[model samples]
Target: MAAGAPMGAGNSSRIYKGSGWKLLFPSWIIIGIFLLAPVLMMGVYSFLTKEFRGGVIWQFSLDAYDQFFFDRGLFGDEPPRLEWTYIGIFWRSIWQAGLATLACLLIGFPTAWFIATRDPKSRSTWLFLVTIPYWVNLLIRTVSMKFLIRDTGPLNEFLLSIGVIDAPLGLINTNFAVQLGLFYSYLPFMVLPIYAAVERYDFSLSEAAADLYAGRWTILRLVILPVVKPGIVAGCILVFVPSLGAFLAPDLLGGAKTFMIGSLIEEQFKGNAGNWPFGAAASMILLTIVMCVLLVYARNQNKVEAR
Candidate 1:
């Protein structure tokens, strides 16, 4: 009976371990097949030569990387002359994304504070309203913006009717339009995180600051900002990363004037210039930049937690 008891205990232990793995097996399969496989394929494609047609050639080459930094044989075959075109596109993407993030912060902070101060029932309602735009397709939303802002659109017609201007302001297909589109699209993302932080915040600190005769600005700077810093960071990251790779807004709103990295990558793949290898290289570069940003964010978070 004692020997049989020991065997039963071992079997139960084995079954427990097996069950644990069984729970994680599907997630592992999904990550391996969907995430890891595509990334691996992209890495391989980045190194291969691009065919003149549309796909990649099997031969490994560094031409794609070179294309980003140099104009081949431009200096009478001395060396590949430095070309800033692709680098400029990356920088433009960063600039636009950063601007969009800043705009989100500017708008989101006040909106979040307003929502956070509302009654619980109203808070949910306001958040629902904020997120309602997301239910509509992004492409559709951007196109709608085009209709509203274009020269012959409703905005111009209304202004013309009101005697605000002699001619319609050329608002569409401009940088301002792009920024507006990004801000409108990502505002909810920025607001929600900050609202969560505000809801969790202790108002006692603000009260204490007020009791000490601190100015409103001082109280906000010293007490409120620190408390909600994490939310701001989270919101910034959420807005910035996606904005960096924004294609639809830049393509539809900014037009030919704004050539961001996302549009540049799209051009390489689907546009008249179908260079798959270069596109893969550009994607990898963008991935590396995003990874670096995440690493920095993680390190900062760890430091804050440590303190």
Candidate 2:
């Protein structure tokens, strides 16, 4: 009877293990339908010839990439020169994203540390407060930002009322406004990850370093930063990647005076130009840049793990 019972349990276990493989089919199907298909479509479209208005021909052409890298005269007959316009746009996006990431880090670290060091009973409240702003729609928040910083908006008016400035700051429709928007938009992303890491940290290690007569800066530089680095990296990636492709802050806050990569790609497909292939090519290029950033991070992680 005991031997028979053991055999029955073992058979059931094997049956469960065999069925587990089937469960992943749904997840695989979703990824294939959603993620891989769109990327493949973009890749193919990038190589195809563009049609007159909003479509692509089956024939292959590199004119999309050529247009990106080279400029001919208003008439196509002029000799091609290296193009700086799109390159400048890309550089500007990168610069703006980097600045936003830096601003998030500078403010988020201390905010996270303060929250993580609080009493356990109050930690949830702080986190809740941090997240509450996000429950509102992002578009609404962005528009509200636009209203607040406009030359005659409440912020400038308050400054004027306080007699701090003779005139309105005129913050609207400038690069500074765009940076402020990005920082406000992504601050929580930076805070939450760093908070999670800090919450898990062992404070005893800092105490030990102090007992050994290590200075506060030294302990932080050698011990705390190393331990919480993964979270910082995660926060930076979360903030930087989205900022790189963001259109809303740039378009609304920046007054659409300059084109970021997101706005440029959007214009290609949706504006009067209606260049489908060019849009696809731009998307592919952006994807490649993002992939390169991720790959570099992965390589650094691998090296750290090996060490």
Best lDDT among the predictions, by candidate number: 1
Task: Mark the regions of model 1 whose C-alpha exceeds 4 Å error after superposition.
Answer: 1-22, 74-78
What digit string (tens of lDDT, one per residue) describes model 2 on residues 211-273? Answer: 999999999999999999999999999999999998888888887655588888888788456
Clash pairs detected, candidate 1:
none
- Best TM-score among the predictions, by candidate number: 2
Lowest summed lDDT window (length 10), candidate 1: 1-10
| Clashes per candidate (backbone, < 3 Å) | 0, 0
The global Cα lDDT (0 to 1) of model 2 is 0.90
Model 1 error, position 93 (Å): 0.9
Residue-level lDDT tens digits of model 1 in 234-272: 999999999999998999999776878888888888955
Give me candidate 1's TM-score against the actual structure.
Answer: 0.90
